[model samples]
Target: MLNLLSGLIGLVTLILMIPAVLPLLGALNWILVPIALFGAFIGLMSSKKSGQYFCLIVAGFGALRLFLGGGIV
Candidate 1:
């Protein structure tokens, strides 16, 4: 349960970080990107099962974004 929660939180954090981090990187503030990515990696690697669930969630969101209007970003 805790692993699942961590994965969910990490997935959400990555989604939220993208838009905010991208613009800042273009504006000359790219340092946070690696940090955020590292955090995501750590979160995902914490548990194998949870990581798989996280991937499924991300893929689902990606497909939804591609076919629909709403997106994680």
Candidate 2:
């Protein structure tokens, strides 16, 4: 149950981050990348049992960004 909640939260966070941060990535000179990645890292680290789910959510967003050429749909 906790894992499920973490997964949902992680997924929501990843989705929310795209539109909110992508624009700033350029204006902020890429500084936000590390911050965002670090936040995701922290989220994963804090949830030992749901770490994989968080990582998967992060990776899935990365892959989507790579292939889709845009933010989450």
Candidate with top TM-score is 2
What's every prediction's RMSD, in angstroms? 7.7, 6.3
Per-candidate local distance difference test: 0.45, 0.49
lDDT of 1 by residue, 15-44 (tens): 753554332232221333343344445556
Clashes of 2: 0
Q: Estimate each model's TM-score.
A: 0.34, 0.37
| Deviation (Å) of 4 in candidate 2 | 0.5
Name the 10 consecutive residues with the lowest summed lDDT in model 1.
23-32
Error of 1 at 1 (Å): 0.4
